[model samples]
Target: MMKDLQNKTIGVFFGGQNPEHEISIITGEFVIAELRKMGLKVIAVYIDKNGIWYSNKKISELKFFQKDYAKKLENLSSCYLDLTLSRNKLVLHCNKFLSRKKIDIDFVFPTFHGLYGEDGTIQGLTEFFHVPYAGCGVYASSVSIDKGLTKKLLSSLNIPTTDFIISYRHEFTSNDDSLIFKIKRKLTFPVFVKPARAGSSIGITKVKNADELKVALALAFHYDTKIIVENSVENIVDLTCAVLSDGSKIVTSDVQESVFGSSDLFDYSMKYLEDGGAQTGNAESNLIIPANISNKHTEKIKEYSKHIFKEIDASGTIRVDFLLNKKTGELYANEINTLPGTLYHHLWEKTGYQINEVLEKMLLQGYARWRESKEIHKDFKTDVLNNANQLKLQHHSE
Candidate 1:
């Protein structure tokens, strides 16, 4: 089955109208390179920030983007996913009068990070086109993006999470005092405010007082209408684990500690914009594999990771983050990255597997899941439509 998949064409999609667009481009390039190494026919599908889709061989190389090749119209061609076709295909054209080109794709490897990309938008599109996608489905992607909703879902399963308060933009703007008073009354000082639906820690702030909270709320609201404020955990250490499933069995990777050292918080600056340049693709270098935690903690994190993946019905490779107290042994799940940066390739690599092997497993798993979905009885053999009755209209005729 896996060998047969190597013969199919894969569409590598990246770049979107989100803050993580640049990172998505890097990830897309990495994925395209890895897929090509497996001797598969891969097509580059680049979606610019303006939501314009372009397909061309030149778009597959990173040097093209480094030189701003997208701005040159002659170097690229406009393309769109044709949903009218039975299979997922990319339609390329110069103009309506010109002959259009079509590229048939059997699978899609979406590398979108935030907003429409990871928030179920791209996954929904793949479903409409009837193609096997490489990550979570629409339901899981949408649910995982909302921090508040993810916490609620985990809490229902008896999972631990920090106490949080949800703040809406309208309420914060209408009466700032009332909202702040409620937050202070319910939670203590030194809270973390984050955009409800965002990635890369784009709009996150740690507030130590009411004055700081006000500024943090403004920044967070700028990114998303909904915001989540959680009581800061004492002596917190970031830990992350990745899970992969083949629709039946699920496996987890080793726990990796995110060492922030003296930094107050792991903001966007620390993750990407620090040092010389962006560290989006090289983030794994900062992680400490087999995190210096107790065996009990490691086992617990692995179990929780698998449980959360199954609970959310996530497919492909998904990474789950956690906040563990160094002083205490308490652990809480932070959030689930449906499409983690670099596909969490480092975590899987630590488990004694190469990138190609891991990706092949994901592709086979996604295809198997897609095939299983087709086995379900979507259209029941019922006569409800044929046995329907007509109703008379009861309205004044003009």
Candidate 2:
């Protein structure tokens, strides 16, 4: 039935200049692996940190990520898509000197994460290119990627989220002490400070007192211009809920609880360094089946999740993170990961769908969005372009 994707030259586009660059690579590689498993012909396209694009042979090798990757990558030829011209087709202009070799891409599966990629930039480019892409459109991606914007939109919809002190970089650096006092006065200590636009908890810090506030601010501002510090959720337990869509409808996966080590919060080391389970290294989460929570709680979270999805007009698959106050059992939407890890395939795996199946569904959604977008048109046989004399006279008069 889905024969259109068979050897369709799908572009598995990932990698870029973001703090989440490495993580994006992991996700992109995993998505490509799954796509290949479905027997789909994928043209792996990578956007390097310097903004150079690579494709074909250079993309398949995982070792291109080694310490001297750029030097190694310099040899394997480069490619780029010229959307500056008419983007009605997937023709890629290799290089000016070389004969233009147009890549006949069926669709683009953007597995990019963090700033420049997730913050509506890449999505906007795709829209201009008129290319089919996985996940939300430009509006959803922009609103949902920016934490301040997302919070305002969600709050307007009555979505429950933590009360936060959203601070901008320029203002905070001027008066850190006064700002800290304001936070201390308004909200209690043990707050969570994070860069507004990051994921995987890269620039997130748990500050318990005034002493730790400065350090946390410095760490967070390194990643973003704006920072948000949420009043501590007494007994923070994270609940991650994922939703998959094929544009027409959404199917949710089971809620999973992330249990932390008793000693401290799940720092980067605890989350990723743990090599073996129950060991000091190799980050692993002890996933509790069904979350060991009441059905009522599950239903509340699931309902709220779907509501947020529809309200934002988000499509494709998204993972909405929530933090549950251990005492109150309240679920506060932490943030929305627009392009979540491995598209949150692990969550679906627990729900009976394999990686290949999930990838297939996402591709279908991509193509569906593409087909639907064809209904809109900004083009027309305008008399202005046809009558060059009229346009020239209008410009001169203005």
Candidate 3:
């Protein structure tokens, strides 16, 4: 590992337009704190509910973001990543009269949970700028964010996954009865309706009958244009495993079983609003570490978790959720979170690695990946532009 990153300036981006905005803030703050403790120069980048990007040193402290910081906004500056090849920097500009300033960020750690932040948008920006950033790349983020797409891909690969049906907003508005009828005919009752491209259980509902299904679909549609209705596993238990990938080697953490307190399923409150919520331990949904399961089952989940990490081409840290059918003894891959809450550091800690250790490793790995990318041959030996001109002449003759 590289000995020092003292000179490097790292940007921690958190909060977004999605429903999980507050949760993202907490996650971002936690990461910022960790980076600071490591004696590194950290920049706190906040994305508000309006999707406006701002940078402020005050953001490094949790108090500054507990409520609306409108009064303090004047001190902060609006910023955007400068993707121009000339520089891999963050451009912060405010008034037209003031000259624009640029901050060179050695690395970016995105803590945004859903939508634009975690769904490859931020990663795409970093990749386009040729900057090193932690977490999954564009392809992995895009593939894992869409629940319907994840199910299809996993099922196609012969990976166990619950059966699901997808519905678009237009189709629902045009013919609700048709979509409802198809779902009922294809799957049994007690299904889950969720926004296809959502996280933190922001827009999810459990439906026991057709009437409830309609209501759930309406709620889910409000959050996303596309919705997914999946067969709910009976007498099921939720399990999650964290995966960390560094180049060729991939490591999976101990399995965790999430137990709900007041709800039958893990919802938004259980995930973010509860005691110590996602920032530290269990949160509202008490998580059992090294999940109580047979040794064989434990190994199976870990194996599947590692496989999904590789299959998605994921880097950095990823949390893979699993659902086990109590009656059938079947374990199904639920979803992959490219940027899991708190980076699932709690799980890793229980598995023998501290949060800081993981973060440092990830930073080094990200830098190495960036350096390796620079060595790749991007230009072709053949003169493609000249050949294109000849092709144009040939096309004119034809």
Question: For every model shown, what is its TM-score relative to the native structure?
Answer: 0.93, 0.88, 0.92
User: How would you encode candidate 1's per-residue C-alpha lDDT over 170-224 as one tens digit per residue?
Assistant: 9999998898898899999889999999989899988899888788899999999
Q: Alpha-carbon error at 221 in model 3, in Å?
A: 0.9
Worst 10 residues of 2 by lDDT: 276-285
> The CA-based lDDT of model 2 is what?
0.76
In candidate 1, how many Å is residue 386 off? 5.2
Give lDDT tens digits, candidate 2, residues 177-292: 88888888887778889888886678989888899999999999999989888876777776878887776777788987777757345555444445532111122355554577
TM-score of candidate 1 on Cα atoms, chains taken together: 0.93
- Prediction-by-prediction clash tally: 0, 8, 0
Better of 1 and 2 by TM-score: 1
Q: Which ten residues in a row have the lowest lDDT in candidate 3?
A: 88-97
The residue-by-residue lDDT of candidate 3 on 29-122, one tens digit each, is: 9899998888889988888777677776777788997776766765677776554532454544433236665666767889998899899998
Candidate 3's TM-score reads 0.92
Which rank order by lDDT, best down to worst? 3, 1, 2
Name the better of 2 and 3 by lDDT.
Answer: 3
